[model samples]
Target chain A: MNLLLSSFSSLTNKVLMALAGLFLVTFLGVHLGINLLLLNNDGGRAFTAAASFMGTNSIIKVFEIVLFAGFLLHIILGMMVSGQNKAARPSTYVVSNHSATAPFSKYMFHTGIIVFLFLLLHFFDFYFIKIGLVAPPDGIASHDFYSRTLLLFSTPWYSLLYIVCFVALGIHLNHAIQSAFQTLGLNHSKYMDAVKVIGSVYSLLITVGFSIVPLFILFYRH
Target chain B: MNFTLKIWRQKNAVAKGEMVTYAVSEISPDSSFFEMLDALNQQLITSGGDPVAFDHDCREGICGTCSLYINGRPHGPLKGVTTCQLHMRSFKDGDTIHIEPWRAKAFPIIRDLIVDRSALDKIIQAGGYVSVHTGGVPDANTIPVPHEKAESAMDAAACIGCGACVAACSNAAAMLFVGAKVSHLALLPQGKVEAAKRVQKMVACMDELGFGNCSNTYACEAECPKGISVVNIARMNRQFLAANLLSEREKVVNISL
Candidate 1:
């Protein structure tokens, strides 16, 4: 109701970025758990049930709106933060040293862009198909999200792209997990080490968990 | 010690600047960094050359005026110490040291190795203090502050406003400096009343003045001469969030029977 809600500050922008980022982080876990159902030998039976529930559930439908809003806000705020950061230093140092900083921290924008591109391609491959804007592959039910995912992963190029994007996702999450906490003001001296450790474990889980599925489909599913 | 110095030299704030090399030999290892620079200045004056202009006051490290970006690190290759406190003994004989000014759009160069850090003062002016009436000091024990919060506030109060945090940060963010000021005052009973408004105004001023957002690089904390912890940055963020979210009073509705 005040100017604070309408206006922006550096901290406000960062808080938005962190909240949206953590929300997306939670979504990644849910997504990875659902996608892991692909590994079952029941020909996508469990995966289809879960996927249909996700697609049709009312609560999830509301969450989908929230999720897209989060993504949009995160992206817009990210771009503004990056732009302001760039403007803060118009001239580059002839010799800059970033040895003290985390190696992955420097490439956040690069990895984020890669992830964005991957998300777009992923949407085209699956989401666009579900909305009926694109035709489904032969012998696949229009609602058979599992067969389509399997077929997409079956392609060598598609699988390679997925793996590459997953690696980028891992790198992004590695810095982002702990960074989100620090941004959200959850950092403390006593628990800092634990936060970092948990962040790394979560990042690894997301990366390895999602990545193995594509490799499994590409190499062993036939 | 004999050392080759690559020093940035500029005639004025708007002039083009470049790194000029000078060799100084027979320097005492016991000489502080600023003393060595003084020796160099004497040699330059004697040689009829323009002496390098840098900022320094209270060579004992209390004043945050000695601003030097040395060897890609702020305040030379030391942690928890300012440029004035660094000694020549830290560098080996015949070593080459690079010195530059703290560079940022907000902190423009005033001269060689000197940047005008008034942008920090501006941020402080925005809301870095609590408004108070002119009156006698309150009894220290009257407001009982927990030992931990007092110690925490003191830790944050140690910030010297040296601008090293901005220079060390890859994005030239001033979050550490602003965080220190905000956190220090926010923790004290005298400062709690205005804490919400203070954080909001200070943060907005920081963004408006062209300081970047912190990405949690920890560089600011690493190169901070005062060793101000990023914990203060987190604390400032918490204050900001609380202010942004909870400071407003919502309107109450009256239902008719």
Candidate 2:
């Protein structure tokens, strides 16, 4: 225990970061699935049903606790590692080259902060109302999650912010999935290419999947 | 070929350093990078000026002593070769090559382009050895090792500890250097007895020395003079995990008993 804690080995922090990141990846899929129900044109019926089920389900309630904990841990650890990385080089180079490093991967800290700020605004808009801290929009059912989403995305500025954040998410997820696997010691030359491919596809899916929603609301909301 | 050199200059460890530009002409294109530096130093001495200081030993690349950051790339633009092995032919006439010391918190500047890499020595002292009986060397075939495993271990063992990995890393991480050492020993049967303790101690020393965490940037593997693979880093991680679990199990058993 002393060795583990006292060492505070980068390996431990990295593995924990990767685990939390992968867990959050799963959460994104589920969250996106729930949010996509907004496209049901009949009404907010399907969205409301799904949101209500999630809001009321005991298992999901428990999972939400784990989800938030994972988020908190990942954010704190990411900052810690990033801070150390910065401190490791007290002096700046006059001419630095990073041709070997991935372009999108280099902006990890930037993308992470963008995604974090976006999460805060997103939670304030939706989760707060669902949890009763904030009131739902006028005349909409309290549990009509879809209508509330529509109300938020209907604002041009807000919809644009969502699109921008989803793009940042795409960049973050692109590097993160493969990075997590590499950190976990799951990398191999034979399959690393495949892992990177899967990462890009997954990132594209989540980014496009979530981005299309707000665009549809802004453009097609009749 | 003639060229201008922008070399980092510092009077002492505590002094602030800056790049000082110098010119050299009539340099033979076939000379090694250090030979070009030697010619410049001779000129500086003749002019009664302070000669630029740097580290080099056994002008052959194997010594791991000729550490240099030329034109923003460790060991210059070439791959899998140390600065000592880099010849002037790799550069063109009139190209101003920038030479700086390996920059990291653990590696402080001693003078000019020379840095104190003793911090890495401390990491090595922490575990980079197999404790065995002092006697006649054992027969090579005494320990039966799988061919592939032996080959992989040798590959890891090729790390020359040049600190180029630290200089090249975006995060200034030394994981590649430390990982190569750990995997090299951990793969061999002779090193198994102290494998767990070696990794733990080396890692503790590495963290304490102010090295950064590896973020999978892989700049270390790319800039490594020996071309040490990033796979060694993953192997080290696996070894660390197993060691920690084994130690934890042992502690639990002791307490229960």
Candidate 3:
């Protein structure tokens, strides 16, 4: 019975956490490449082609279901884990600060919230419109979705929002990426340092890469 | 240096507690926090009040008994230190310092600041020992650990079984304490035979004690008086995951064969 419980517990949360986290990290690399298309002119031929392929691809649809499950599982497990944490230490923290603590620990829930909002915006954006889940709001043409993304960037506020969200994504990735490997028992310092650098670079690329789309459309869109 | 203290006092474990105020005048700034508390107790005796009860031993910081949440920080806002080593000089004249026991469900307070930290002792008992037989001492060099490995082992061994890591953790997880114990044993040649069993046992004990899981918050490392590394926690994870997988695979192989 104990073995059963332990095995189940490990598989449900810890194992899923690792798998989802690694899967999401892959999405960062691919998504970054796709996002870089905003650098193109002529109302986003590159953007539309990539968007259509992603939208119509049968394999991506299956992955999309998995992605959705992964997102919910990750968020739910994160909360359960945090809640368990709060229950264990019911006492209040008195330290004004602890530098030895990782920066990720403090802003965990906050970053999770920001990332969730970013996903919602992204879904309403390409997922909903591109896939026909819902027509683009404000009579925005389907082909003009790229231009819509560009025009949204025309407002500094919209650009600022994406930049801020991406920054949060970067911070979240900084801790999450390497943390996944640690969970998977990859703790050797020789290799872990390389993982940290990879995680940091990947996080930076995705965040900065996605944020740049807004800046490009805001500045260079003709 | 005279000082006023707001100490958290509870009649018993069943009762809810609050910060009952006390004044300890003419305190020597050089005296450790526990010594300052001793002075306050002396005054309490004279005034016909209950002496404040807190845990301590060895006056040195090694015992991990003197856990305090000074001001708003564990072990008094200082880094890489414990409550016993904390001096009155850390506080100023007329400062309203808050004192409380380690706050956790697993560590029930017996009275005042004295908590039943045997939960930690229980964790150690689960996997903290080696299975040595009754025999004469082996040769000094019979099992020689490499310098680097021995040093690393010693680093983990530096843990004094203190529950400060639990207090410092937002989740009140005992991962650092458990990690320290696991790393100390798992790295040495003497401990390899039992590494898998030790980690599985210790981690199970920790979880059973109602301590939370590790989230790599690294708070335990920060508040630890020994500055026990978060790397130790990672090491512990590696040990546990590898042990479970290896043991499981062995069982499967045996069954198949």
Q: DockQ order of candidates, best first? A: 2, 1, 3
The candidate that achieves the highest TM-score relative to the unseen native structure = 2
Over A112-139, each residue of candidate 3 has an lDDT whose tens digit, in order, gives 8899888999788766776678687676
- The alpha-carbon deviation from the true structure for residue B233 of candidate 2, after best TM-score superposition, in angstroms, is 0.7
> Model 2, which residues run further than 4 Å from truth?
A1-7, B134-141, B248-257
Across B36-121, the per-residue lDDT of candidate 1 in tens digits comes to 99999999999999999999999988889999888888888987899999999999999999998988899999889888899999
TM-score for candidate 2, please give it.
Answer: 0.94
Candidate 1 stretches with Cα past 4 Å from truth are A1-7, A137-142, B133-140, B248-257
Candidates' DockQ values?
A: 0.58, 0.62, 0.52
Which whole-number lDDT from 0 to 100 does residue A143 have in model 2? Answer: 64
CA lDDT for candidate 3? 0.79
Q: Which of the predicted structures, 1 or 3, would earn the higher DockQ when compared with the native?
A: 1
Clashing pairs in 1: none
Judged by DockQ cut-offs, the docking class of candidate 1 is: medium
- Per-residue lDDT tens digits of candidate 2, residues B1-257? 99999999989999998989999999998999999999999999999999889899999889899898898988999988999999999999889999999889999999998999998899999999988863576787877889988998999999989999999988888899999999899888888778899998998899999999988878888888888998998888888888887665445445554
